[model samples]
Target: MERLEKSIVITLCNLEKIFPPSFFTIMIHLVVHLASEAKVAGPVHYRWMYPIERYLLTLKKYVRTRSHPEGSIAEKYLADKSMTFCSRFLHNVETKSNRTERYFDGYYGASTHTSLTKLEHGQVHRYIIFNLDIIEIFRNLHIEDLKQRYVYDMINHFHIIDISFSYLFNIYV
Candidate 1:
């Protein structure tokens, strides 16, 4: 737990350079620390940690549906492009299944294209890149503080984005 706290402190300090000290950054760090600790601890910890996980999960779901009124044009563009790339990739995978059927002959493929199309893949992708961009922006804003925050922030941010994306996708499809 000491190691986790140290890492979170280092991450918070690093993020502080670009993000301006805010509860948002602190919550993000705390959520990440708890997530990591939960993984190492047993099911009892998971049961105890349910409230935190549930809160984070709720935040993620809200973020997924909410519009980004403050996002820059470039950020929007990258997100759209990433979503397009992912959608196209999913489409290709679904359509090309039979092209390599020898290996998956008996396996059944469920059709999900219709549901997938309804998903705001662009927004989902954008949310992810936006989180990553936060770290990059922080790094660029304070190169001198690189070591103090980069690794843990990047890891936590990525994990959060991934969890959020998965949650949204599960709901969408």
Candidate 2:
């Protein structure tokens, strides 16, 4: 039990370093891992995972501030796609277990209440297309270890970007 807690802390710290702006990402990853493990271990294991629940509250605060404002291209795009993905994922998961809502709430926070207007919607769709193009490059790869490799690659890429941006921001400001 001590070792498991230590491992979780270590993983969270490493994830924090890689994804500096969002502790929530680490929490979501933990929940995904826990959810998979809990299938066999059962609900009693969640007591040990209570830290994740605390993090979900923190995530809610973070997301409220981080939301892409109405009319922004990035906001529009992320909103639409996230809604669609959430809907489908929620449906699929709910069919298998009631725990799905708890996990979704932990990850996405509150759902958007309304749909975007046509002009805003158009901008979002364009952003989605651009994102899909980038994703497609990864989809085409035939590597056997792509899932694990992709996570490491993404972490490395984000680390570089974070360092580069911090250096540049400090120089200008």
Candidate 3:
């Protein structure tokens, strides 16, 4: 700040014939106060403009129509906030959030065995890739050794695998 002030004063004192008096405008004067700005307002990032700019960008996304965009943004913002607040009190409300396995600590869903049955079977093109867990389950349930060997052969032969639904065993293999 002292360096900037020194430079500014030096430049003003040594104002050359090439530089016009109009160059010493209010904008130039404003640059001198920038050093003291952080003393008044914490930091540049934590200032009011940061959150305002973020909200402005969010509000800009709500504009579907070109006409009266501010009104549309305001309406959408209020509606979304109200719906989110209301969803907390409501039961069986479908909040379209992109989440898988909601709430880590709670026991909200069905049993582990029942949930496992709902998972898609791993596959590769026409060949199905059996899941390791399902194979373990099959071994416990006394699945044939020959069928297990066939599943292993399919896995070893084709490296590619995908999670898909299979109807043969009605299990996610």
Candidate No. with top TM-score: 3
* Lowest-sum lDDT 10-residue window in model 3: 157-166
Q: Write the per-residue lDDT of candidate 2 for residues 2-49, one digit (tens) a residue.
A: 456447767766777887565564456664366446556768755576
Order by TM-score, highest first: 3, 1, 2
Candidate 3, position 133, lDDT: 60
Where is model 2 more than 4 Å wrong at Cα?
A: 26-40, 43-173
- lDDT of candidate 3 at residue 91, scale 0 to 100: 60
lDDT minimum window of 10 residues, candidate 2? 138-147
lDDT of 3 at 54: 88
lDDT of 3 by residue, 1-173 (tens): 66765576667556644578877777766766776675677678776677888888998999877798878888999998997787766666556442336656766778665322322322232243244564555433433433455575654333322222233245644
Regions of candidate 1 where Cα sits further than 4 Å from its true position? 20-26, 32-173
lDDT of 2 at 59: 46
Most lDDT-accurate candidate: 3
Per-candidate TM-scores read: 0.21, 0.17, 0.33
Candidate 2 residue 127 Cα shift, in angstroms, is 66
Report the error of model 1 at residue 120, Å.
58
lDDT of 1 by residue, 1-173 (tens): 65775577677667667674554643575555674665577456446778898966654544432466334444655676676666666745553332455666565777565433434875666566456654455333333343354565654564544555455444644
